[model samples]
Target: MSGRFDRRVMVVTGAAQGIGRRVAELAAAEGARLVLVDIADYVQGVAADLRDQGADVLALQADLEAWEGAESVMARAHERFGRIDILINNVGGTIWAQPYEHYTPAQIQKEIQRSLFPTLWCCRAVLPHMVDQQAGVIVNVSSVATRGLMRVPYGAAKGGVNALTVNLAYEYAGQGIRVNATAPGGTEAPPRLTPRNTEAQSEQAQAWYQRLIDQTNAHSFMHRYGTLDEQAAPILFLASDAASYLTGTVLPVAGGDLG
Candidate 1:
């Protein structure tokens, strides 16, 4: 079946599992030549599975939280694929759930590092290439949690992402680069293979986490979590020619939450 991404070179970060992996899978099915990146070594297995399904794929292990990592990923991806047509920045997530006061300074910094720097650095690194070619698409995976409780730091980071998306789209539109974001609400997926946090949750901590979940459902107009496909579909659309005229738009996948 002919697909929207036929022969397109697409780079997906955080592709080891969850939303990132699902994006890779769907893109591959649509004929994308994939560069799947994650710090986890097991991303190679994800690449292997796609290869077995007759897709052109390359997997790289890189700590996208670092500038060096983002540069290297783009450099190597362009080297392999000749040109980059799509960049899906999917490397950030919340590592802890708690009130603002409960977090240490170090924890706040870590949250920013994990959820903000990667997107910022990747955009900086990839812009030169996209600008040189005078054509590209960037879709950042942000979150509805930007307005939710129990993850103030993470919310702040995603808020930064939202700002970055609009500003970059404005800066690069003249050069033919379209930048957008998908702000996902609660999504149902398999248990994380590598947990973001390993500490055993105390009763208070567990209660706080549960509260976040309850709040997510209560705020959603649909009153439920979405599936992986629901999240990936909008992301892919933003990355496709179908969204040719759409730029600087943050599409909310959060039922009714405008965040």
Candidate 2:
């Protein structure tokens, strides 16, 4: 259990699946004590698996988009672990990818809630403990789609995440807290058991989604989607002492497509 994050208490949001789940697994393998958070019940299963492998882990089901939920998660983590060493804000996704005009007011609001508020709320919730300890690391999951996308609302939300990272890093660096972000490119992972959007999509909507996928690949120098590990590695690096000198930087893991 001796590794870069040995004895570190790390909280990873959106830990039910995809890049978030991968981050949890990799971090656990590297000796991090994990607090895995998600709105999905499946997050418990992830924690159980890690525990079976002899990792110290806790899983909490909470809606990170709400301030109360974020507060509860951080409070519980502090109560259990006695310190907040790392926070990876990974809860976000594009629910619907279409032209800006096609998005209704509700849809636009939901997009912002889904892709931005969780990170915002979680950062605010965790900062008090981190600042009190005068030491912590935060790696927010941003997206290259910020510049190339049919999902304008989602892009805007991730843009906010990048801004949050820079400003937070600037504000807290003197206190020994580091804040950074990883803007992942198009990534390949399994289909979600629970899709981000459960509503049926129309043919036009599907076409717009395809355009997003096409443009993502076209804009990448690799001309292909990155693997989940490819995306998670940089996140872990930023969370580890290996990146001790890094702060307030947004590293783009987009195969040369800097967004």
Candidate 3:
């Protein structure tokens, strides 16, 4: 497990915390030259912390939902590292939990913006460089919620991620690029440093969120939430040479939930 990456240039988005941060940390342990990116300035603090521990890291803040931001991130990564060997597209999360009908038009749009376009735009932005190198790995963090509970828009966005993974793998295999995704079920991590939603939760909203929790646990064979390491390990596997023969597959990291 040690030194598996051995200085491979890797980019991990949404790397300020959680699964993304874990991936970057583990990869660094294995000798990856990391480019950590997030929309929050706090990602710089994350990078600084990792540097203190003797990792080669460059952290950037960017809104990957926009093309310019995505393009700039990849461009800077390439400029600094010279070649990109792996990309872990780990941005996106559900901001609201409710019945589809309860969501406003703006909320739906934001869900798509938050959960879909970042992966879409980043994939598009990185493909050319990946193609030029003719070898790369992409592991997108999708969700098992694509089949469970109150985040219909988020589910749909992840569905798009699934489709994109398959099609991109088909198109780019000849160029030695592998694209895949991991669908994580309920994960138990620390509270977000920056909450995705700042609005106070109403009783109805709280109930709606509870339903999501119930359904997630009910469907998982383990009937439990997984730890951060449980989720991060599979993602790193998909991004590693250990998965050399794997491509275009969405591996479910949920104990038994296939979503």
1-259 in candidate 2: lDDT tens per residue?
6588899999999999999999999999889999999999999999999999989998999999899999999999999999999999999999989999889999999999999999999999999999999999999999988898688999999999999999999999999999999999999999997998999888988999999999999889989999999999999999998999999999999999998
Clash totals for all candidate models: 0, 0, 0
CA lDDT of every candidate? 0.95, 0.95, 0.93
After superposition, candidate 3 runs with Cα above 4 Å error: none
Could you give the C-alpha RMSD of every candidate to the true structure, in order shown?
0.7, 0.7, 1.0
In model 3, where is the ten-residue run with the lowest total lDDT? 1-10
Worst-scoring 10-residue span by lDDT in model 2: 1-10
Task: List the candidates' TM-scores in order.
Answer: 0.99, 0.99, 0.98
Count backbone overlaps in model 1.
Answer: 0
Backbone clashes in candidate 3 total 0
Q: Candidate 1: lDDT over CA atoms?
A: 0.95
Compute the lDDT of residue 66 as modeled in candidate 2.
Answer: 92
Model 3: per-residue Cα lDDT at residue 191: 94
